[model samples]
Target: MSRALRAPMPDLFLGLISGTSADGIDAAIVRFEDGAGRLRADLRLGRTYPWPEDLRTQLVALGQQAAPLTLDDLGELDSRIAEGFAQAANRVLAEAGLTAADIAAIGSHGQTLRHRPQGRHGDGRHGFTLQLGDPSRIAERTGIRTVADFRRRDVAAGGHGAPLLPALHAALLHAPGEDRAVLNLGGIANLTLLPADGAAVRGFDTGPANGLMDAWCLRHTGQPFDRGGALASSGRIDPTLLARLRAAPWFALPPPKSSGRDQFHLDWVETALTGHEAPADVQATLLALSATTIADALRATQPSTVRLIACGGGVHNPALMAAVADALPGIAVVSSAAHGLDPDHVEAMGFAWLARQTVLGLPGNLPSVTGAAGPRVLGGIYPA
Candidate 1:
């Protein structure tokens, strides 16, 4: 395999992830070559394969409920999701005029089924997270080495096992005397504070971002997401509902924390509603809630962040962007494209980078960001 790929020295690594929104799988092929002292990634090819309707529906239903699945059901769902990811990888390879044999490996984030940064069980204090989709299956199907299950190691080390991209941000975006925060507005929002003064990096989950808005939009308009946040734009925000939503106990928690679609679902949102509000109004408030929480988290950073660089699907929504910028009067809330990487590909690129790190046996988990006991190389590797 090495001899076959070494003709061109295959620097290509693929990353596949279905974010908390449960909408689709983003497959990215990134090339990593030496840049000065560190390896820098160039996203060569990227595409999102929308989940099949039935799988998408199941994902959304499971995400909203965070309900338990029997072992049999769980196994079947995992294998099916892995097949989707494998097909996506094949598609991207075809588009790029490459084959599985020409690639290095795949870093699969899988499909996050459940994430609890902290929870209780009969045994002891446990921090468990589940990302379904079998890496063995991915390796078998793609005929490429696969690296996945990137989070659990940190949890075992007593960390939150999330907000895993701050190290990537530091490597890719940090600049001297220019403190910045990377806000990943996926299904849920996670903010990473990169200090200019060379202080330790800090970040945590801010709360729901596109997940609730997308869910609401689908329920009301039959669309997968609120395009440009138009529905949210059309409706007025309900401050009372916004306040109630923010009043959730999770927001008050300090750093090294994280939340997920599993924690903040449609049912969770209903607890904040008074049962006498417009659906669009609820969506507007949800958007407002996301913006305000993100801003609040940014302001609360210990060293005080200067700029906010946004990414993920939410960055495409103009109304959400404007609201976040409005929430932070002086701070520049800008898209990540200004920093070199496309917003759509940043997270996928991170996973690709992580795959390289794992293959090199370098530490991928940041103790500062994840609250891990120490740095550890993350991910399980499955050979082709």
Candidate 2:
């Protein structure tokens, strides 16, 4: 469909998501407009609300598969996460001086617990991805329509059910005559490939981003993260360790792949260690791994990419960004901020755009990105 002929859509939407980092709930209120034969999103407000300490600890443990969970435990965690998400929504709304009625709907990309796009047996048939935080509760608490569970349907259709933001990236960042890619450096890094020829967008998880780095940082420095990659900068990259980390089988998988903390936690990192490496060196090597893997993927899959626009938490880490730029010598590395989007809030804003898509009955996933059977409208709606 021509951009000029697209139907008008509701302007205001709230997006909520707690990424694999389990850092906090990112909430964004967006106003979308149709302009110049294209859709544009104006982020009216964005905020990250911290999780209750205990809830955060449990979430991290569950995400890393560090703690075993029973059905009852899962139920409790689900409700608590929903309550946390609801609180985040209300807080952002209050700070913006807006009532629930002022927004069109909420798009909640609930907290992901497990994401097995290829299933346990390496077959697509039994694959499933799970995200918690009940949208029904979100709708009830926020007194607004809600859209959640955005991934499972794609997984059911034989897709990875992740890297869902590529559609939004393509819509907002695609440059018609220049091959570009958007790299999201969240807990796990993923890339959205945008070809200059107007071909279908493609995306997938590249590998570990901040998730492993942060985990190792916290374990060594007692800091949640290495703030600006200071710790990593203080050490040298251990080549042997870096090589071992790079040899992980997942890295060999082709596109349409996805991963999470469940796959690349501290344990996964430890398995590659020789017990003689310094903590700082390990941190440095991990940072190098993220940069190298991202560069490798781009070179192997989209070598023609001229510009790489980066977003998400890792963008704030200068060491990582510099490493990426160094690794991809010919590509221009820039931030989404340069294009009018908040680096930290792009994913949250994406969910808001997704909510609007669900309300309009528009397809959200890119089959090329997720390996889904085809484009399909994502998410289930919970009316206010």
Overall lDDT per candidate, in order of appearance: 0.88, 0.93
Off by over 4 Å in 1: 1-9, 66-68, 121-124
lDDT of 2 by residue, 1-384 (tens): 999998654479999999999989999999988789787999999999999988988888887789998899989888999999999999999999999878999999999999998887777658989999989999999998999999998998888999899999988999998999999999999999999999888999999999999888888988888999999999999998898889999999998799999999988888888799889999999999999999999999999999999999999999999999999998999999999999999999999998898898999999999999998899999999
TM-score of each predicted structure versus truth: 0.95, 0.97
Count of steric clashes across candidates, in order: 0, 0
Model 2 lowest lDDT segment of ten: 3-12
After the best TM-score superposition of candidate 2, give how far the Cα of residue 10 lies from its true spot, in angstroms: 5.2
Taking the tens digit of each residue's C-alpha lDDT, what string does model 1 give over 184-207?
A: 989999988888887898778889
- What is the lDDT, from 0 to 100, of the residue 143 in candidate 1? 96
TM-score of 1: 0.95
Off by over 4 Å in 2: 1-10
lDDT of 1 at 69: 81
